[model samples]
Target: MAKAFASAGDLTEKKISFTEVGEGLYAFTAEGDPNSGVIIGDDSVMIVEAQATPRLANKVIECVRSVTDKPISHVVLTHYHAVRVLGASAFGANQIIMSDAARSMVMERGQEDWDSEFQRFPRLFEGHESIPGLTYPTTTFSDSMTVFLGSRRVDIKQIGRAHTAGDSVVWVPDQQTMFTGDIVEYHSACYCGDGHYEEWGATLDAVKSYDPQSIAPGRGDALVGREMVDAAIANTRDFVDSTYNAVKPVAARGGSLKDAWDAVREACDPKFADYAIYEHCLPFNVARAYDEARGIAHPRIWTAQLDLDMWEALQG
Candidate 1:
């Protein structure tokens, strides 16, 4: 029998947890669900990665309230994914910031991406009606931007492309804490359907340069120690590299996309099968890896129809 499309069968709700990884730095994680980071600056608060909807985002907001009553002054969207940015309205932040590349993606393919992801994972879209429509960045930066919440400093860089062309990370220099979106998952699947494989690894190198002591990943628990943070970076990088290695040889030998995907799945499954979103991300990750292995540079924009067609062709 063929597998279901993406996460269509995943309907159970996940438990949420908030961890204070450092002074005023918090990680809001929902078991294998989408994760968020809360940064309480001296005077205000900044939330990294809005949840999938206003209702869902409120959950994060509530978690933020638990520790600090500071206003959510800035909402940082590390990338332009529907599940990450659509809930920006809830925060009423003074500024919604994103990389220029991400802003461009929002204008170019935001709606289509929204439709595709909404259909792929219904559980994540539980409060779809709460979204006010496509969310746009109030402020856009080209490479890097620095913001201050009183005495605290948060540095955001449009580091090399990883999860998307506009992927970025939030760095807290004083506390040595980094909030990496989907770019560096901890024991969780890295969704690469829109990723740049080679550049993703290079971007991980940039992240490693920070030598962060505490790291908050896009989908997993907060890493409070240096060892855990390093392991998460290595784990994410290895997953991307292994996929490329397995798929590249097959593509070079003129094998079909399905052949390349099967090869990678065979090789990567043992190590990553139990990870969060592993099952749902596999087909899409393989599809993108197959294209990159065969020399494609920009990842093709995924649409609702593309999701079904590709799933049927590759999975069915």
Candidate 2:
């Protein structure tokens, strides 16, 4: 397993990095952590995903301030993961936008997910006490919604599900750029704990359909150029396929989760040895893949106990 999680004990507090992908589009990324995007318009700015807490979100706000002082009018949630959505309040956006499916996930598992994520990733929740409560969207849509930043247009759509049931992407056609939340990752690991491996490839394909010149993924460095974009999507797809295919046969034979995990580890550790968080995410990834291979359509909710139990069972 790669040593991505080995540095978990050394993680510093949230810090933001702003990379300009276009004239007004900036990709705000943290250190191998959840990312938020900024789109500056003539009169206002729109933030993509909110961080995990107000403290974290404020860092993104600070970066935005460096470029322009436009009021943050809208905060768009790419999905309903607690680490991504709970920080909405810090932005003080007049309108919090999300897909209809995302709103449903918030209502269904928001609290449980919030608890589960906090327990698994303590560092990301720097000031957990500062969080007011669960975040709910003020505006939601089923398929697509368009918001204009004065003359600039930002399109939000629930293209398809991959990482979770409510995964969405922010596409700026004019800039030929896309902000894909967990739908794509570069260098960093793809957290498949709540992912649908079968549909993940298709989701990547959908994102590629836009032919984005640049893409800010959920984590890692922002991708530039069509070649880089395709490579990133392919890397994410291969990661999912390798894990699922490696574990499926073992699962079909009624092998134990441990046995399946071992098989997947041996198969993937060679090819994906350099990817970030490979070790940190392998156990959870294997568990979900094993379950899916056995016909479990929906990913089982992860709790703290489940996390520790799986870690010990597979990594012990």
Candidate 3:
């Protein structure tokens, strides 16, 4: 292969930051790694996006402990990705929630995703053995649901599809803060392997319509003020648009996947070369974009072997 497969060569530990985006609301970020959010209500706390393993989840728990002593009552997963859902067991929350579509995806390809991600990024899966198994949600909602943590009212809604088929966002009406899973990213590559490129813009629009004052994105730093929030959303949109638009033309002309990869690099590398996980996500993003442009609706499930084969083919 021309270079390391995905993030296998990335072994250095990242700097973790727990930033406050709103009153009693925090965003747990690790440089450019996947981020998690904390919503402390009057009587209890609600966690968004569990880390990859129990050990990693402990890091977020420690941050939660520093601010408040409320027991975690519920865990709301924004999506079904292994990196985000596998750590649910550590929270010991009374209820775990996900979108109805996310649960179905878990039943279909959760294990395969776990294996594929474990192989691509060894560092994120530290203490992988501790993961009880595929994380399943105890409850799910179709369109939107409201959970009141004591007096705090939290609104969870599936705005549209961007990062995944069942992507959802958490909104705190009082503070005008929203926790957008992978739908919006800041200074990090959006992993579009299972994304819907055509529908992502509408999803972004749905999120923007709220006029959120603060946002805890799926990856990158926490956006505090309205200026930062708007900037991050715009940046995320550009990243997604550049990737799909670059590949759509190639696929329309019956070009090979390699051709699409080169086109995307030419378009995106100049602007996003320094973005976190850019190289790791490029191949998969290009492959998915090409498939979408060719009329493939659902993303093909990725396995460990398929990951290696795709990397080798793209390198050649």
TM-score winner, 1 or 2: 1
Residues 1-316 of candidate 2 have per-residue lDDT tens digits of: 5233223454666466799988799988866788889998889999999989998899899999999999999999998998898888998899999888889888887888888888767788878898999999999999999998888999999888999988889988888999999999988788898889889988888998888999999988888788888899998888889899999899888999989888988888988877766778889899999999999998888877777777777775
Clashes of each: 0, 0, 0
List runs of model 3 lying over 4 Å from the truth.
Answer: none
RMSD of 2: 2.1
Write candidate 1's Cα lDDT for 134-196 as tens digits. 999999999999998999999999879999999999999999999999999988899999999
Candidate order by decreasing TM-score: 3, 1, 2
RMSD of each: 0.9, 2.1, 0.8
**Per-candidate TM-score against the hidden true structure:** 0.98, 0.95, 0.99
Worst 10 residues of 1 by lDDT: 276-285
Superposed on all Cα atoms, model 3 deviates from the true structure by an RMSD in Å of 0.8
Give me the displacement of residue 188 in model 1, in angstroms. 1.0
Steric clash pairs (candidate 1):
none
How well is each residue in 43-128 modelled by candidate 3, as lDDT tens digits?
A: 99999999899989999999999999999989999999999999999999999999999999999899999999999879999998
Where model 1 places Cα greater than 4 Å from the true spot, the runs are: none
User: What 10-residue stretch in candidate 2 is worst by lDDT?
Assistant: 1-10
Question: Where does candidate 3 clash, by residue pair?
Answer: none
